[model samples]
Target: MEVTHAVEFLLLVLLEKLSWSDTKVVLPDANVTCIIPEDCILPCSFKPTSTVVIHWYKQQIPVHSYYYNKDQFGLQNKHFSGRTCLFNSHIPHGNASLLLRRVKVQDRGRYKCYTSTRKHNQEMFVNLEVKGQCAAMVLAPVYLGLATFTASADCFYLFAPAQLWVVERAPIQTVTITMTDEWVTCSSQNVYPVPQISWATNPPSSQHAIENSTIRTTDHKGLFTVESMVRIVGNLTSYTYLCSFKSADKTQVWTASWKNQEDLTYEEGHPVLIPCNAPQMLRNFSLTWTFTSSSEPTLILRYDNRTRHTVNQWEGQAELDQDLVLLGDGSLLLKKPNSQDHSGTYTCTFTAVNTKRIFQTNVNITVAATSVDEQSMQRSWWSTAASAVFVLFTVIVALLQCVKQNAKENRTASHRHNGTGVIEGGLLLYMDLNPSAVRVRPHGAGAHEQESSLVTGPDHCDRTLEPSPEAEQEEEPAEPAEEANEEQRDRFECNEPV
Candidate 1:
């Protein structure tokens, strides 16, 4: 009898829609799943003729937890602000689906839709699943990253989900969204076979494509750099973009492809291993590391089956363990992650042996820890060293250029300035060694050049007096002498004949 009852309940449990006929309230049950850093919209509708109040709530501890409505809890939860919006512009007499702007893992909960009519009250349940979206979203997660993603509605009913690729701002690949009853999937495996996202364009510098390329661009606090590079507010902030290549045949290729939806939290000084992989069996693969400080790709290191030192500060310290196996379960290990490694996308590339089959994975790491005094001191030393080296290089180059320019200027001046010119700085080609003359144009002066006029002291302009040698001598006295003389002289000594 119990088995029959369960079977009967399963057979009778059918997905249905709500109606607003005759001032009666009816509810429907639906389930929704979204990934973190992605957007999800709840589909809902109501009959246009019913005069009812619709409310949405997150059902968990409290009996009543309203999220969206004209009033009430709408003003309470700040997280839902600008994130929850009504799908239909005409809500009173049209669809009332709620659109959650950016979904997070914590947002997974049971959502209730209530419609209170003049005569009856009805409700619906929306089961939400907030899983990490694409491998990219899990690997390199950011809010608002999920935009303009729509999969075939029919995919939701299929068993084998199709890949849904999100191509925003022409992301160099065609992405298709295929859904299945169990899950929705997104893939960027060149559905249409486009060129890889140019690392040159990633940091977006005017640079060429290279195996290991890095670009550095300062992202101002309020400035948008990548998609819509706009300065909404202030000066630029610094960010690094790394461009690398990986192959499918490299050892530990799967580790690179596996992306984590959750943020990796770490304590200070401890090394963390990030899984990296090749597209195929990890056998023939080449890995490189690069860093971007600003609009330029600073090459760090390239794996030539042998480790090579790079000019990048971080890459110089990078070392790959030869004894460790990178095939089948490919992984990249960092010796020690410091606060300096806090923000940036770490790219791992794999290349097939003697083939062009390359696979790549990007992992964004955030390091949060208090640095030890020694580590801080070491960081300061390295920072100072790098700054000093850069400054020295700049100064040396500038001095050399100045010297070369000075020689050129000396030659040019020898030809132009027969007796008076001296080389002051390099490359001042347009500068006048001996400025001929500057004519001061009086207020409201005409456009044409005017004849030179003598500039006199304020009291003597256009006013001439009889020659008084003593007074004339006093005119050009030193400032201190003038002050002393003024103090020594009597106040009424200069008496005007009345």
Candidate 2:
């Protein structure tokens, strides 16, 4: 009976220890699969304490530990030497996570966390699964380093693998909403490892068509110097562009991405990648994509995961990946999505096992306004100048016509003034009345004045006569009297000659 009671007491003590070790860590029941050769973090938390003591174990073997306000890893396993760490600053905040660097296949196991402090203590467990070396997912993983990308919308597209440890579901890190002539530059200097540069365009352009052109050269100090000059905004154009720099050794990386507005924008005349996120891991799915450009909705693309079939009504303008459809990414590939051909609202309806997800993206594709050709402007200016010259010439011709008409009128007036007969008749009337205005005659008598009537000159002399208004009106007899006067003047001159 004594042996039985002792066995029962020992069993009770073991039960108490097991119950006390059961702790709360991040994703207690979930298995976190870490990609090989990358750093992995096993998270843990405890009650806050200034005097912190943390111990990590794998099958009762010490992996890492910290005590007396300092890391005392002398008791850590040699297999994990220099590969484990506890964030010292986070200890006071109840974080007792372990960072395992350069993960290997042997590192895959269930880990136990034992934490202690002056006031409280806690414990937890973390199971890390290791994936095959270089076994990458079909969905491309963005390995961001020490780089900055401004104005890119393709940043939030990193989806976690199906039911695995999520490294990072990517999110937008940077964006630049700038006007024309704005130069977005990403450069780095005095770096040890040679750097690689690339650009991520909104429409997913080819390498040749990307805007970020990075120039790289090694300096004398064996450090890499890299510079990228994103050229001027070709037009008053809006496009989501990103420039990323990564170290060749994959140690340091920088990635920057941004969106122009809350609504998405696509590049005109360039093939674009329209992003769609599935609600969950789809096993058997039916996908439908409807596009509304200006009117009624039309089905542009449809796919079935069960049959591995695709229907595209866009006439080879739309593309899809059936392999990636099973995963979380259901992004559509559009060829030359332009305002003329692809401007609209796109709706992606993904129906799968236990999930019906709908993703929508408004594509506002703006084609760069065609520049007014300089040659055409020159032609227009020449046309305008020619029109002005033509108008001036017409005015000059009109003025010349006026001058000729005035000269003809003046000549006609002079001819009429000189050839009028009424003026001659008026002169004859003056001779009949007072002839002094035309010819004047005075009487000069001599010795023969009594014999010769010529000396008296009663008819040769121009006499001043007083005529009534009625006699002056009769212009008929005045002309004959003028003729007789002329004959008498001729006789007078002949007789008076020496």
Worst 10 contiguous positions by lDDT, candidate 2: 446-455
User: What range of 10 consecutive residues in model 1 has the weakest lDDT sum?
Assistant: 227-236
**Tens digit per residue, CA lDDT, model 1, 1-498:** 657645533432221123233555557689998855567887666554345455676752211222233443322245576677664456666566777877754566788776554455566788887653332322322233332233221111111123223322212222222222222222334211122322222234444322232222222111111111111111111212222222222221111111212234555466766654443555545565544333354544456443322233455345555444344333556666664543344544443443222222233444443445678889999999999999999999999999999999889867775533233331112223334421222122222211122234565444322323444354464444455334323221333110
- TM-scores for all predictions: 0.24, 0.27
Residue ranges of candidate 1 with Cα displaced over 4 Å: 1-28, 49-51, 60-74, 134-498
How much does candidate 1 score in TM-score?
0.24
Q: Which is the leading candidate under TM-score? A: 2
- How many steric clashes between backbone atoms does each model show? 43, 7
Error of 2 at 70 (Å): 84
Report residue 444 deviation for candidate 2 (angstroms): 38
lDDT of 2 by residue, 283-349 (tens): 7878888887779999998888888888889867888877777776778888776677687777777
